[model samples]
Target chain A: MTRLDMFIDRMVSQRACLDFAIAETALMGGPVFELGLGNGRTYDHLRDRVTGRPIYVFERAVASNPASTPPEDMTILGDVRETLPQAVGRFGDTASLIHADLGGHNLAKNDEFARLVSPLIAPLLAPGGLMVSSDRMYFDALEQVPLPTGAVEGRCFIYRRPTA
Target chain B: MTRLDMFIDRMVSQRACLDFAIAETALMGGPVFELGLGNGRTYDHLRDRVTGRPIYVFERAVASNPASTPPEDMTILGDVRETLPQAVGRFGDTASLIHADLGGHNLAKNDEFARLVSPLIAPLLAPGGLMVSSDRMYFDALEQVPLPTGAVEGRCFIYRRPTA
Candidate 1:
């Protein structure tokens, strides 16, 4: 495989996991959350797949393809440090699905961000809801679930809030 | 991306797809079929994930890792052209899940084989069941499905038998 093949695998896997999550959580009544709306490709995909639910996008600055941009009402314009906590207060544990693709080229930096953000993201999920991320997250409450078919093992991670 | 990375992606994607298919079709009642059980790695994985269902392996020869080989009662020995027809006679449209990873390194040969074997494999699936393959298959009766996450596009394919 070349660099192009690797990239294709990542992209295909991401879409596959997200699609599976959308279908699995279809019956659950709650909003969806998208962290890091870079280029808004995944967000656009989500809008196409998910119905009858709000998809809240968190972004510090809105810079994405014009056609893929989320509506103002649905986009939360702020750093996640402030926005995620506030989201918990407003939405409670009601998000049926949350997707994050926040990793950068720096592995250490990405890991640090994953650690800082994992706790903030955990409480937003409904019991039995899923958290899909491109990086590993440390969540004491959420248990990691097996990746859906077509998803690369380390390329994407899925964690579920147990329905206890 | 290197060749090793590509191989890893293929293996992981294969497992992810198989696991997803297994979980999705768990409620359906029928046997599982493994076509071309080379080395029986996938056969072993299937045995581990699927329970209370007979896993029939179709092979031209019996050589495999001793620990991974299917029992004599479940192994169908012969060319697929002969055995697949026999399978249709014996099992009909009652396979809950059918997995085929029969492709080799030769693209042209794999494509030819896929074309030849596809119709033979199509009639084995139960209504609403899934077929996970390592190569693109031509199925007139089965509809191609979206691949699950972690599965690289073109690295694997999934098809479903629609319930009438």
Candidate 2:
């Protein structure tokens, strides 16, 4: 498959994961988190799936489609490294679902960025909360989970902050 | 278009209306209703779309795909006129969205079925609730709404149980 095809497959997987997470979190209540808001496609899709939950988005600058951009209070700006810690402080262990789709075109740089943010994300999840992403990742307290049905294997990663 | 094409178009329109209603009700608070569970295709779609809302489904018997059938408590059996009234008694004015796609292939019969159940459904919607259906319908309390974008003009009908 071409690179573009593979990228699109990853996106489709990401969306399926979001849908699955939304359904799983419906009975279990908490807010949602969007780690990257580029174009806001995922954020908009998340809003449609997870009704009635507050969604906090983290972004470095304003580049999302105006139609999809979140309102001021819901959006947290500045470098993720700086803003995410503040978010963790404000919304500690309160997110039922979190989606991290950040970084530029450089794969190596993206890995480094996620590695840097994983720690703050750990304490931001509610018990049994779900975290989905476009990269492969693992946290000591977050147990790895299967990709939702129809999602391509290895394209998207899912984890649950276990209640136990 | 052939009969098959028209049927497919109707199904597509039904799905689009459900998606539209899900987005519309994401901000509103209440459960959802599926008036007909035939084969449970639409019910399954509603489950996927409105993950957070309880979908109480009404049906006469077990004709739907076993995989798609709702749990016993959520499924109402017997004649809708009877079962629906019982449901309305228990869930008075609590539904955020309701989809009625009952009856069989006969168009006139379907219209009769919808007309009979309209009163039963009237008192079941919360303020500003949405109701989507296959037949043209009017309730004194429900104002007709435009079909969601991309839905066939006359194939489906939309309504809102006005808050005012």
Candidate 3:
């Protein structure tokens, strides 16, 4: 598959895995975290797919379509490195799902960023919570999960915090 | 696959699903609840697969292998209907994973039992927790999950309480 095909496949796979994750962890009634605002289509999709759950959006700067922009309190602005810690202080391992779509031209930088930020995510997700991202990430506290059926590996990475 | 092959497939499939469920919810750090203790084999597998997490076994009587019988504090004896309710009062939505292998020679009776017990599982599981069972069960609070890649759907079922 071409890069474009892979990208679209990743998104479709992400939606499927997300449905599984949500069903698996729903009783937790925890907030959903979105890292990177971009066009807010994913945010919009998330809100529609999982109703009644709080979705907090973290954006370096707001550039989303006006129709898709999250409400003020739900949107966190500025550097993610700073905002994420603030979020941890407030949400603190109560987030049921977190989606980080921060992949870009800089492959090495993306890897660096993923490595740096993944550890911070552990404290923000509830046990059994899911973390989905475009780029691969690793953290001792998180466990990788298989993709949905028909989802090609390496396109979209899925991880979960063990219920332990 | 032959019935014997299918039966073996179901066990292998169950192990895979259990691993996924465990990875997804380990941070909950609650007990793993085993609903049936047939021969104590699966219970032994549960203990070996997940160390550090407490494993609670519910059996109608003590007929399990001596090596696999859970300690007194972890084993609940008597009729499941009565013991289960008591378990709910004590565990109360703290169980991260519940594996119910209550199937028997009487399919109809097993189905009846599953229907009767399905609802009781919700209060014992943490929100977003998992229920891996042999009988097909449906509850409004629990969302059914897709089976693993190679698993036959009707043989084993997975469910999760809605995060709400």
Candidate 4:
């Protein structure tokens, strides 16, 4: 396969996992969270799929496509190190779905960042909530769930907080 | 991306979609079908994942690894064009999950076969039953559902029979 095929697979897999998570959490009464805005395509998709729940985006800055940008009230601006902790204080463990695609092209850097953010993200999910990430996350409390069909194994990762 | 990466993506996507469909149809009171059980890898996977549902395998021959072969009572041997229609006579519109990975390496051949079998497969599904195919199938009555995230478009396809 060509590079284009590889890219398509990643995009498709990401969409499949996110859609599954969105549907899985539909009945839960909590908000959704997007860890990075980037071009905000996934965030836009999330907004379209999620009903009766607010979608909050955590980003360093608002540099996404205008059509995909989140409303001011839903955008949490700052370095995630500071902002994520603040979110824990405000929202506690009530996020029904959280999606993160914060990895850089550099694999080593991505791993380090995943390690740093794993704990911060772990505390934000509601029981039975799901976390979808482009990079593998290190979470002690959350169990890594199997990816839904059509998802490349290493291309995407899903974690679920135990209901207990 | 290398050819190996592409192969891995397809395999992963196939697994993900089948798993999703299996979960989606779990509550329905119908059996599962596996079309074209080559090497029986997927047939084995289906047997493991589906609970309380009998799995039926359709094939022209039974040449597969001993570990993966289906029980004789569950295997239907003959050309699919002949056997599939016979199946409809015996079991009409009650398959909860039907998975087909019948395509070969040749794309044109795969598409042609998909067209030929789509109708035969369509009548076997229960309302709300799911059909997961490695190739895009042409079905008049079945609605093509959106592929879940992480699934590369054109690499796999999912069709659902209307619940009504």
True A-B contacts kept by model 2: 0.00
Q: What lDDT is obtained when candidate 1 is compared to the true structure? A: 0.87
Q: Candidate 3 on A121-152: residue-level lDDT in tens?
A: 77898888989888899789899988877556
Per-residue lDDT value at B128 in model 2: 88
- In the order shown, the candidates' Cα RMSDs to the true structure are 15.3, 19.4, 21.7, 15.2
Q: Could you tell me the lDDT of residue B50 within candidate 4?
A: 86
**Range of the 10 consecutive residues with the lowest summed lDDT in candidate 2 chain A:** A1-10
- Which ranges in model 2 have alpha carbons more than 4 Å from their true place? B1-164
Model 3 alpha-carbon drift over 4 Å, by segment: B1-164
Per-prediction DockQ comes to: 0.02, 0.01, 0.01, 0.02
Q: Chain A TM-scores, one per candidate?
A: 0.97, 0.96, 0.92, 0.97
Write one digit per residue (lDDT tens) for candidate 1, span A1-164.
Answer: 32333444677678878889999899998999999998777888888889998999999999986767899999999999899999999999999999999886567999999999999999899999999998899999999989889888787888899999
Q: Write the per-residue lDDT of candidate 1 for residues B42-152, one digit (tens) a residue.
A: 888888889888999999997776767888999999888789999999999899999998876677999999999999999889999999998899999999989888788
Model 3 residue B50 distance off true place after TM-score fit, in angstroms:
54
- Give model 4's TM-score for chain A to 2 decimal places: 0.97
True contacts kept of each: 0.00, 0.00, 0.00, 0.00
When sorted by TM-score, best at the front, the candidate numbers are 4, 1, 2, 3
Each model's lDDT comes to: 0.87, 0.81, 0.79, 0.87
